[model samples]
Target chain A: MAMLFSDPFESLFNLQKALDAFHASGWLEPGPSAGGTYPPLNVFRKDDDAVVIIELPGVKKTDVDIQAKGSTIRISGTRTIEFPQKAGIHRRERIAGRFDRAITIPFEVNVEEVKAEYRDGILALFLPRAEQDKPRSIKLP
Target chain B: MVAPQELAVQPKKELTPKEEKTVPARYYVPNTDIHETDEALTLVMEMPGVEKKNIDVKLENDVLRIEGRIDFSKYEGLDPVYAEYNVGHFSRTFALSNKIDQDRIQADLQDGILTLTLPKAKQALPRQIPIN
Candidate 1:
């Protein structure tokens, strides 16, 4: 029985590796052509809701656009920097440009009830799971 | 132009001292942007999850040190489902040259961004001389 499952598991691992490689190439759709890279983000599940936290320093709230559909959420924003003319820049490590990121939740989400908040350069999103996607305890007669 | 330090590890001495404190297992070197104007040098650093009260900026022995402590306790019992960023403290140091006006250095923290302004010394400021 172990041998029977090994082949499929190996194939699944290979598929995951391929997906990782694709993402690392920085060619994901709606790419960073605007000079911005993907912002760091975190996803946590609590009870029946999925919470997503994103770091977007130097980006104003007005510049951010978020859209959610079914189980996918898309976030896009722009970061701009302005320096005085004739001023010499000694060092620059922060990236300033437009960025787009799309994340797929593991479970279906209730689109209408999703809530979002931006504070302290961080964006937090609360997505409630769909009725059918949430786990329920069944009553046994 | 000096390249801004990106995710550079702290020297051993700096790391050893912090280990005795809150004892964070890791440190994330925050991305920073440094700009020099005729008046001063400005540095902007990105450090999310670090509140204004938790940031420490010190200048001593001609070195400017910045450390931001992350409050991981905020997530106390929440299980992490996915994470693309690590939860840890942020630290970096810059050696100040004699041209910097150490006494006038100013720092501000807002919305997770730290801005530091290091003014230039009077002697270092450029001035136009009248032609004789």
Candidate 2:
């Protein structure tokens, strides 16, 4: 099965394929992160596993919650912006509120093997494909 | 039900390259919030994926420049499939007035947000009037 897929840009190909499918289905609406998703994410594939990187500046680890089930993962967190007493805001651009996002991947993930790390206000999730989702080899008689 | 759009993450803005730099790399402008109090002005900037060691805050000739270089090594060996935002260094500049106490400026980094405190000079502070 691995021999059949030799393209080094498999990840990009998959992305294009996903976009094509969305276009064909008339679901070519803007991407979830275009303006509706909090804490934009970047998905990457490495071997049979995948990693999701999220940018959540000013969010503490204690405020974030992650859950994985089958092919979908949920991330929920709250961001609080505090100002000094009697502060007069001149310019406000940074946002603060509760955020929750659920994302689905192509392959089922092994919940036991899923790991997450938050560093410098960025969250990285390592998800391994489930054993049953792996391609099985067959020999022709 | 769809959540309010304002609560979602705003699109990250890419810095427009005005001139050629020594290093050819894309840069981003971090979102910033400015607030003022009786004593000082505070600026909060969001620069995710940047560490304290990789950040530079300089004040030269009444211009304050802030830059944070992202650690690209953290992304090595990973092939991007779907990218909602690009990974790049952060750069933003602000002009300061003489009313600001340049020597008393303080900076602190916490949870990827840089907080800069610029104390006002003695003459710049608001003073109460006295009636004889």
Candidate 3:
């Protein structure tokens, strides 16, 4: 099946970057409130199936919890990073702690058939459209 | 005990390579944290979706370079519908001091995070002096 949907937010980021380049300083920098959502996601759809990918470095599978209901999916987890007691922090930029995010799709999700895979700190969920939500063709006499 | 709160994912920053590259590919610098102890200096980098075999660590002229390649074949037949971040190879470099013993440096990769330990030279370490 050919891929039908593409990330709608991709254009927004491109536009923001272009504006930033023009002004050298982003007057519209959404700051930490907007655009900076935890556990960044990428969604791809092929026919009636959609795959959601999340990047979570140094996270354990046991820490994350995923749930799907109707047209929404929720992911919640904690990220912990530990160092020796005597170690001194030189420069810290990476983030840690807990994160919870919810995403809603256009069609009802087949929660029972959804498949999840975690590898190399990346979690991907394969969601199929619900059977009842699929379009049906009617025959005329 | 305090409860943990939600974290914001920082926007990915792009790093432009200074020198001309043989391959015209975009490279994003991975997020890193540096920690130092009496014995060694540790560097932790976030490089998701990259296998251990695809990473390269190099040292030349007291400069340490790190690079990780991502396999694009994973997205061959897929079309993106929503993307919050761009996928690309990771690249970054650090200038090391003589106090670091490059020969004793160690590297480890786990769960898409790369850790590098650079041990201090024996002579550079502080020593306890006895009373005369």
Superposed model 1: Cα runs more than 4 Å off: A1-37, B1-22
In the range A103-130, model 2's lDDT, one tens digit per residue, is 7777889999999999888999999999
lDDT of 1 by residue, B43-98 (tens): 89987768888899888887888998766545533445555554556788888764
Across B7-91, the per-residue lDDT of candidate 2 in tens digits comes to 5768778787557565545678999999999899899999998999999988887788999987775655666666666667899
- Evaluate all candidate structures by whole-model CA lDDT and list the values in order: 0.68, 0.77, 0.77
lDDT of candidate 3 over B1-132, digit per residue (tens): 677657887877787887866654467899999999889989999999889899998888878899997775576456566667777778999887647787898988888899999998899887999999
Checking candidate 1 for backbone clashes, the offending pairs are none
What's the best-to-worst order under DockQ? 3, 2, 1
Instruction: Choose the strongest candidate by DockQ.
Output: 3
- lDDT over C-alpha atoms for residue B92 of model 2: 90
How many pairs collide in each candidate, listed in order?
0, 0, 4
Among all candidates shown, the one with the greatest TM-score: 3
Q: Which residue pairs collide in model 3, if any?
A: A6-B80, A6-B81, A7-B81, A7-B82
Off by over 4 Å in 3: A1-36, A136-141
CAPRI-style docking class of model 2 based on DockQ: acceptable
- TM-score of each model, in listed order: 0.75, 0.81, 0.83
* DockQ of candidate 3 compared with the true complex: 0.49
Q: Find the 10 residues in a row with the least total lDDT in model 1 chain A.
A: A1-10
